[model samples]
Target: MLVILVALLWFTTVEASHCSIMARLSLMRNISELSQNNYGRPDLSHTTIVGSVLHGIKEIEVWLQNFAPGSSTPIHRHSCEEVFVIVKGQGTLYLTPSSHSKYPGNPQEFHIFPNSTFYVPVNDAHQVYSLP
Candidate 1:
């Protein structure tokens, strides 16, 4: 009788552990599905990211952004080359040539849509604005 009782208790404990693991796996799957479906969610811009320096050879990051009409970035130069992938709306890019300073040329407006990207060379001074 004592041996039979011990065996039943052991079986129940093992089954409970398996149930808990399965529950955790189901939660993880749901999170992954939500991320895939909501890649362009508006809420993404509200989250702030603290800056940190990376020590490795390569680093990658993804960001979602929304620019209000007439919004602009200050003229700045980048030490590293930069790329901007437009996910929506129309905007303007101000690119300066080597011979000119103080925003060099007239603003170039681009009608960029989803799935488009542009690259700027290093040391290029530029500013960007969204048309109202």
Candidate 2:
């Protein structure tokens, strides 16, 4: 199983005219203590730490994702970049850079370990799988 800390920043044309001067702090808790959901994917669950749903932060979303052995996220893409900070366990990232292509091409595989960090470019197809 693997536990990954994902920090996703959304780019938008709308700018924050007034930034909050007040700072916010989030206390880290046990993964089981935080609210989590699979979003319909089996063996994979995620807890949102900072995002529009919780902290009302419009520009960024932080999540803690847990994957059981042999589990993976669906092949997906987003308009905004997605970054991952590996906290524990090992996994493989399948990435296909197809920003301009009509269909996704072959994917490049990358191995990830603890303490490593990686980012997915905007609109690229990617999937993450946890090794048993």
The most accurate candidate by TM-score is 2
The per-model lDDT (C-alpha) reads: 0.44, 0.82
* C-alpha TM-scores of all predictions: 0.48, 0.78
- Summed backbone clashes in each candidate are 0, 0
* Cα distance off (Å), candidate 2, residue 132: 2.5
> Which 10 consecutive positions of candidate 2 have the poorest summed lDDT?
16-25
Candidate 2 lDDT over 2-110, as tens digits, reads 8999988865445433334123435454656778889888798789876553454678888999999999888899888899999999999999997558876799999
- Measured with C-alpha atoms, the lDDT of residue 97 in candidate 1 is 50
Measured with C-alpha atoms, the lDDT of residue 69 in candidate 2 is 93
TM-score attained by model 2: 0.78
